[model samples]
Target: MSVLLESRVNGANLYRRGKVRDVYEAGGDKLVIVASDRLSAFDVVLPTPIPDKGKVLTKLSSFWFGKTEKIVPNHVITTDLRRFPKAFRDVRSLNGRAVLVKHCERINIECVARGYISGSAWTEYKALGTVAGETLPAALLESEQLPEPIFTPATKAESGHDQNITRAQLAGLIGTDLARELQRLTLELYRFAHDYAASKGLILADTKFEFGFHDGKLVVIDEVLTPDSSRYWDAEVYRPGAAPASFDKQYVRDFLVQSGWNKEPPAPPLPPEVVRGTSERYRECYRRLVGKALS
Candidate 1:
C-alpha cells in the first residue's frame, strides 16, 4: 500500500504482452517479468484497477516458489528490486511485484493440475464425459471430486486463447517422455500444494504451471500459484453438491456474467465497489495461505 512511481527501465526490450503480464527481454538470457494492474474476467480485462492485486500475486508466487523448490527448479533470479541495475531499480519501489528471471526457451504447453472438478475440467466432464485425456468412472457428478489428480495440458497459443490438447497430442508436441514428465511433475506439485493449502483452511481447486528448458533441464518458469493462475475456495463452504464460493477472480467473473457483456470486443468496466471487493478477496487469500500479512 505504499505510494510508488510506475515506470520501467529503458534498456529492456519488450518481449510478449500476455493478458495480465508484460514480459521484457532483459538481455543475456534473462527476462524482466512485470505483473500489471490489469484484471481479466471472462477472458477480458476490466477497465479499472484492483489495488494491490499485482502485489498479492507476486507475494503468492514468491511463497510458492520457496515452498515448491524441492519439486522442480524455477526461473527466479531475484525478487529484490534493489539488486537490479540503477535504471531498473525503480521498479523495486513499486513493491516486490516484479521479478528478474533467467529466461529459457519456453515449452508451448500449459501444464494444468486439478484435484477437484470445476472450471474447464467440469465443463469438459459434462461435454466429453472425461477429464483431460482419460475417461472418468461412471457416477461422477458435475462438481464431484476426481478419483485422483490428473494432468490437463493445453497448447500455449501465441495470441488470443490457448487450446486444450489431449495427452497423445501433447506427446506429439513435446515427445512422449517429456510429456509424461510434465504430467507427472504437475500433478505431484499440485498434490503437495493442495494438501498444504487445505491444512491452512483454503482449498486449492486447481492451478496452471509453466515450464521451460534450461540447458537440457526442465525448469518451472513464469508465475506459479498466483490467484490469477489458480482457483481458491473457502474450505468451510466447499461442498460436493454445490459450487463453493471462490476467493480468486470468481467475484469479478460472476459480476461480469450478470452484466451480460458477451465476453468480446469492448468489455464493460467494473464498478468501483466490485474492484475494491475483489482486491480485498485476493489479499485475504494471500494472508490466509502464507500465514503472514503483506509487507
Candidate 2:
C-alpha cells in the first residue's frame, strides 16, 4: 500500500475540514474525500496519528458499501488504486485511505440510529427520560437495549460538532416525506447491519449516516460502518446492565477520560501504546465483520 502525500483532483476546492476528513470538490457532482490519521475525541482532534487508521476506515466503509448496496445507493465509485485517473493514480499511495465519490446535494441532517442505550441516548434518558427528543417507556436503564431502534436526526453543522434535533424539527427542515424516508431507511440499514455484526460476535450499538440527493434521488454518502462512524462492542463481554467493552475507539476515549484534560481546546496527544491499541482494534473489527483480512 503506497501512501500518497498530495491530492489528485485539480481545481480542487476545499469543501470542509472535518475532524478526521478533508473533503475536496472533485468537479461536477463529485467529491474527493480523504481520511487523515487524525483522531478526534470530544469534538477535538488529538495531536497524534494512529498508524493504519485511515486505511482501516476506508476498508471498513468499502466493505459496508457492498453489504448495504441492496438497501440504498452509496457514493462509492471505485477503490481500485490503479483505476483512479492520472491525477489520482500518482497518488495511489493514498488510495488505501482516500476515495473519489459522486457528490450530491447533502441532506442537511445527520441520520443516526441507535439500538442500545448509551452515549447521548443515555445522557438524555437520565435527564429527560427519552432519546432523540422523544419520550421512552419507563424502566429503561443505562446501557439497556432499546425496544426498537430510533431515528435521531441532528443538524449537519458546517463547522463544529452537530447538534441533535427532533423528528419534527427534521421534518420541518426537509419536509415530512423526505424526513420519514430518511428515518425509515436509516433504521432498516441499521437493523440489517446490526444483526450481521451480531452474528460475528460484535454489537452494533449505534451509528450515524449521511445522505445526499443525486438526480433528485436519495443516496447514502460519506463513510459507513467504520470505527470512526459507529460504535462496536464485543458481544462476548456485553452485559445488559453495564457498559459493554467497546471494540472501537472506547480505548482512546478511556485514556482521554483518565487524563483529566478538559474536553476543550488544546487536545492532548495520545500515548504510543494507546494509538497502537486503537489501530489494532479497528483492524480487528474490519477483519471480523468482513470475514476477510484487510490487504
Runs of candidate 1 with Cα error greater than 4 angstroms are 2-7
lDDT of 2 by residue, 89-128 (tens): 6654466787878878878789999998988888888898
Worst lDDT window (10 residues) for model 2?
1-10
Residue-by-residue lDDT tens digits, candidate 1, 1-295 = 5322233557766787776777777768887777777777656666776777778877789889999989999988887878754557765444567888888878989999988889888888778888776788776765567878888899887667788888999999889999999999999899999999999998888899999988888999988888888888888877886688787888888888899889986788879898788888988999999898877
lDDT of 1 at 80: 85
Q: Compute each candidate's TM-score over C-alphas.
A: 0.94, 0.93
Model 2: lDDT to the true structure: 0.82
The RMSD (Cα, Å) of candidate 2 is 2.1
The per-model lDDT (C-alpha) reads 0.81, 0.82
